[model samples]
Target: MKSNFRHIGLAKLCGWFGISRQAYYQYNWETISSTLEEEMVLMQVRDIRSRHRRMGTRKLYEILHPFLLENQIKIGRDGLFDLLSANHLLVRRRKRRIQTTNSYHRLRKYPNLIREMIPTAINQIWVSDITYWKLGEIHLYISFITDVYSHKIVGYHVG
Candidate 1:
């Protein structure tokens, strides 16, 4: 691969780079070996995805962790993500609404009296929101409570 870099032979290129020709060949071999490793990992991922189509990268790394350890493959979660992205194997994420608020309920809707009012004390007003995080083929729902004045997360729970 280095030969086509220019009209010059790899030997001359190696000389110009001030490195041995063996080093150049070794570098190419290492690149090939690394590419092969990634390809192997991709194969395993495809096999896993056949059964679990919507798996996300984090869980993929967790499942592959044992296999990678057993096979002497050194790859991190981000590296695997990059590889999956390069191969167009990465799963696309979709947002889902959990209907945290039911507008059609019989209870009266409360008006925002404090909409423009700033909280004077930490406990004067507390705001709560629901956050959704995608995990593999599942979605994790977390609710958090924050003190309006302090802007601090006082409590959180995952459902």
Candidate 2:
């Protein structure tokens, strides 16, 4: 096909494909335009990432909104994601573990007294637990007690 096209003129090839020469050139130009647009987006991503190394794609899109408008580049969130993924420029998230329970402690551990017991009515067996809740910049501790039989929260404390 390459050799045959080399011998054949582009106008003739366009005619064979049932398209005009102008349409053929327009399609080629569109490919080039898209390539250039993607390159520009990649450049902007790299520039933003240089300052904020761990910035995610959503934030990058927000930052690039103004630039895209100025350059008349049309790209959506998914498009930006695909571009960043293809270029291997996406930010890797850090795994920050918040250790609330220390199971390795040598302190006395309480045995489950109700392991063999089943609740027949409400308030017969109550379970208590604590959980951590992060609201914006604040850390909250939620302590709650529930009834086993009714599956209802009997008591709760948020601090």
RMSD (Å) of each candidate, 1 decimal: 8.4, 4.0
- Residues 22-107, candidate 2: write the lDDT tens digits: 99889999999999999999998988888999999999999999999999999999999999999999888899878778788889
Q: How many clashes show up per model? A: 0, 0
For each candidate, what is the lDDT? 0.90, 0.92
Cα lDDT for residue 23, model 1?
96
Model 2 regions more than 4 Å off:
1-6, 15-20, 133-139
Return the lDDT, model 2, position 86: 94
Best by TM-score: 2
Candidate 1 lands at a TM-score of 0.57
The TM-score values for the models, in the order shown, are 0.57, 0.81
lDDT of 1 at 159: 89
